[model samples]
Target: MKATNKTEAQRIAYFGMKKMEKEGGYAFTEGTVSNWFNVVKEQDGTTYGVLLLEKRGVCNCPFWEENSEFGACKHIYWIREELAKEADFQSLTETDPRWLHGGGI
Candidate 1:
């Protein structure tokens, strides 16, 4: 299914977290936040995901501009919430993979 709003996207992220916990040996502490990631806001308002690694925000959201939107990708927004307490998956920005939770802008 497609996430139509922040709330729904959060649920999907939670599912991804659960999967992360079971497979990667870490819990997705960023249920409401993410570590380093990229997001895509579709014309229909749906959001997709990309994990950020190193200093490169690799989210291919159609709205992204390499220089213009430098650090504001949805993946980063996912982990860096305004009210988050800083979680485990929140700092693995250097090891983000290209597959799994990925999409092109």
Candidate 2:
């Protein structure tokens, strides 16, 4: 979903992206389902699952659970941006049996 205002979630996402670029503690993995993704932050080594729905995206991160009304959390935003850059975005969304089990990269 589109965010109308500049919310905290967006700021977090921005910083997260910058951190990923500057440091080396982020990992993202595509899920078996086209809309599913796994996001990992190095600070905590926690894997947050991001699920893209028809109209909105969801994340298992605590920040998202509490502030989802405002917009997607860092994990969701990160995965969405990555997916958008893919040349085969449509095909990537298709079900892939190889990703049936979750793994990080």
Candidate 3:
């Protein structure tokens, strides 16, 4: 489903969290550089994930490329909640990533 607004995106993020938890997913954060990581599952003997922080978030996963324009992807949503408590990313610069580009929220 496509998220038309911030509220909808948040709702989707909730579901994503649940799914992650059920699958034993986990995440890590680096407050200094504003980097967040999601411990992706093993697929084809490889472990990979999405990285989010500061003013931009990006996921190498296909899901992000397809659904990012609507709202923060699952990995991004998780990282946002985690970093919200530890970092002050309110003053991002132009060099930051463009994950929150359209300004939905």
Candidate 4:
């Protein structure tokens, strides 16, 4: 969902991106369904995990639970951006042959 307050969205996205980069957040799993994103933040060496859902970037972060009724939180925004970049890079490489045909699962 789009934010009603565009300025707020931009501001949050900006800070989120910065914190994500600086803190080395966004860790994925190592399994067949590799869609889990553990957005982590380390404060005083204490790491906190914000689980990002596979669907629609919904997160388990308290900030998201409270502030994302209408719009996405910074974690979601940052994760979306990262996912988009991965998608772009994958598009340039080999993909599932089924997708090339008309029968992707």
Using lDDT as the measure, the top candidate is 2
The order by descending TM-score is 2, 4, 3, 1
Give RMSD to native, each candidate.
14.5, 8.7, 11.6, 8.4
Model 2 score (lDDT): 0.70
Query: In candidate 2, which residue pairs get closer than 3 Å at backbone N, Cα or C atoms, i.e. clash?
Result: none
Position 70, candidate 3: lDDT: 53
Candidate 3: pairs in clash:
none
Model 1, 1-105: lDDT tens per residue?
345554555455456544533453222222244543323333344444555555544444443333223434434444444225344345435446522244211
Candidate 4 lDDT over residue span 21-59, tens digit each: 676735533223445555554443432234456554555
Weakest ten-residue segment in model 4 by summed lDDT: 42-51
TM-score of each: 0.28, 0.61, 0.48, 0.50
Where is model 4 more than 4 Å wrong at Cα?
1-10, 30-36, 41-56, 93-105
lDDT scores of the candidates, listed in order: 0.41, 0.70, 0.58, 0.57
- Candidate 1 local distance difference test against the native: 0.41
- lDDT string for model 3 (17-96, tens) is 66765775464534444353644454433333556646657765555665676545666766666566444455555556
Q: Looking at model 1, report the run of 10 residues with the lowest lDDT sum.
A: 24-33
